[model samples]
Target: MSFYDVLARGDDALDESPRRSRTWNFFSHITCNTVVGLSKIVLNTLYNVEVKGLENLDQAMVAARKENRGILTLMNHMSTCDDPFIWACLPWRYFKDLDDIRWGMAASNVCFTSKVTSRFFSMGKILSCERFGRGPFQPALDACVRILSPDNTLDSEHIFHGLGPSTDLAASMAKNLKEERNPLSPEYKPPVLRKKTSLLHVFPEGFVCQLRPPFNNSMRFFRWGTARMILEPTVAPTIVPIFSDGFEKIKPEKVEESAFDFFTFYNRGGKVTVNIGKPLDSAIIDGFRDEWRKLCLKYTSLQDSNRMSDELKFGEEAKRLRSKVSGYLREQVSKLRLQNGFDKEDSRFSDVNWWVKYTDTKGKSDPSVKFVGLNWACRDYQSNVKIYDEKGNLLQERKDALCGPKAPRKSH
Candidate 1:
């Protein structure tokens, strides 16, 4: 199949068969090494890097490995280089097995826009995900769930038995692979063959937020996809919160021209700090998971339930529960920001709507608001807002196009 076809498959690009190809694995090894090496140079030579609480990461890895559980590392997206560069803080042993390395997600529009870039990122083990299109409900998130809780019954032999060198057939098989049922379904069952798991790193913010001082370290509202990864997996993945600062300085939103720019990396000599918080309390997670399962059964039995629509499946109660879980996870990262000597963001920042409202009211009063990252925030909000006025009349006459097709679905 053509590269466009592969890109069109979205999360299906993460199938294990093609990744298992000897040739593909060889290149992947090289690609990962080169990227990580460059990241080391950037972090160590070009910029001063300070990493704290590494023991927390080490301990979590050990525990996850021992328990055969997946590890989900959540961090704030400060810059484009956060992924590979962040791994620079890790020891050499972590890079020894490329399979053991973290699998991350990247926007398809940016990373898979062309064949060369698509192949490069795929080999680097980055899953292509939709940002504005599918939002959190994309199949890529489901792929993440499977990655975290892989079925062990299908061994190398079973996977490659009939498939030969033709990647097309392999891709077909991977596409047809059985999918896990909605965890909220009463009939939902965990994979009986599950035994192994993988590590996934996510920027739950879903977009970069390069705020100005005092609030620069603040994170956007964590997306519900993170909650899905946590709530749907058969075994609760070890959730680890990571906080990093100074990457914004390394690759600031705006670049100034200078003769020295050619000689130096972006804003050279900036200090980058990465703090790894302890794996969140498993008991707390389990409590949330149990409550989620009970709610699922409760919603499924409701007379008014619309099973086809995700919004009506679990109803408003599920949305609130998911928001609670997602909000709590964001709070953990926020706490790390505070611990690292950054000022606490206003509690209102936790509300997704608060940013848009602030932009429309107080933000519009200040012309410099765009300089502080509110520009992208307002743009994102506008993109997701659906207007019910199919006719031109209301849109043209209304001063504020606040009317939507329907009540806004509560953030999960």
Candidate 2:
């Protein structure tokens, strides 16, 4: 299939509604683990993945298991490989049974753009959310909250089966494929813990950070939605900060909208480092809130002079709070990077006006034009890019085909 083919079928693919099924749930465990296992070899070989501060995650898991609480892991999103690489680098040897408890909030459009992709991610424990739609953040956030709740049960109604029969004709076929493939499979029930332990990993930035040099000020301030999720009153999982360095090298010479690029990137061989920071629980977040509120109000009032409606005021306050929390998390990550020698004070670029201020040693940026969306591009000229069909047919030719939206790899 062509990239445009997928893009053209957005309406047919996007589904924000809920779905559930007991049979599908059982098969998901089998499929999710299978995909993850295969992905490990590819990621480890290409990325030379290294993990640090594992004790932080180990402790968080311990806390979750003991108290029946959940964990909210906050990581900077540089590329799509961040999640799989994390899985690849984790000390799984010590924790053999802790596989299925992890969950992630993924972009609704990119991750669930098709029924097939949606089912794959859903089984893998990825919840979807719209980035710009109304209440865009609620569905995935709520799912995380519900899953993390200690009283959570693997009730039949709660288990996701697949798309309802009425919605997609292929949904049932996918379900049947699962059952036919595993007729003797045991009934699937999400592992139930006394406190229902789970891990909720999120990228507070909401979008991929620009692929800039390590330790640079490329990381965006965290959006308020992440903070809102962290501060949820019903349940507050311990907030763990994770920093991943070095997936930018995976981008192909011409970024393609194909799964092949994903595999190729990982198989190319590069070093990736993941560091876990200390958890910021309620007390820590509370200590920062008063200052956060002040910073937010000052900035919000300056940005908009007119008085805001109550709802708008709440949103404004929340936005500022998110920024403050993001900044705090950014510092923690920078510290970890610096300590590990992957970062240097002089090598950093300013977040503000990076293109203008941080030119290379010769006062020039890299000559290669970066793939589209917001990125620093050097002056260059190119032409005649090749496009291929799913069947390996040469589909078309175009100039500047690679010059758009350098989206990170889909976390799937």
The sequence of per-residue lDDT tens digits that candidate 1 reaches over residues 91-126 is 778877766678889876557677888888888878
lDDT of 1 at 127: 80
Return the top candidate by lDDT: 1
Q: Determine which window of 10 residues in candidate 2 has minimal summed lDDT.
A: 1-10
**What lDDT does the true structure give each of the candidates?**
0.65, 0.51
Residue-wise C-alpha lDDT for candidate 2, range 1-412, written one tens digit per residue: 0011111121122223222444554665566566667768777655577788889888877876676556778887776666655666664453244333467777655577678988788767777765432232344554554455434422211121122334332233334334232211355322322224667788776656554333342455455566544443224457788877766555423333545655566326677778888776567675554444344334323222222223322455555555566566666666765665664543333242343333222134533323333332221122233444422245554544543433444544
Candidate 1 error regions (>4 Å): 1-13, 153-196, 255-264, 300-314, 358-374, 378-412
Models 1 onward score TM values of 0.74, 0.61
Candidate 2: which pairs clash?
20-160, 20-161, 21-160, 21-161, 68-195, 372-404
Q: Could you give me the TM-score of model 1 versus the true structure?
A: 0.74
TM-score of 2: 0.61
Residue ranges of candidate 2 with Cα displaced over 4 Å: 1-22, 93-100, 133-137, 152-195, 212-217, 251-259, 288-315, 344-412
What is candidate 2's CA lDDT for residue 110?
56
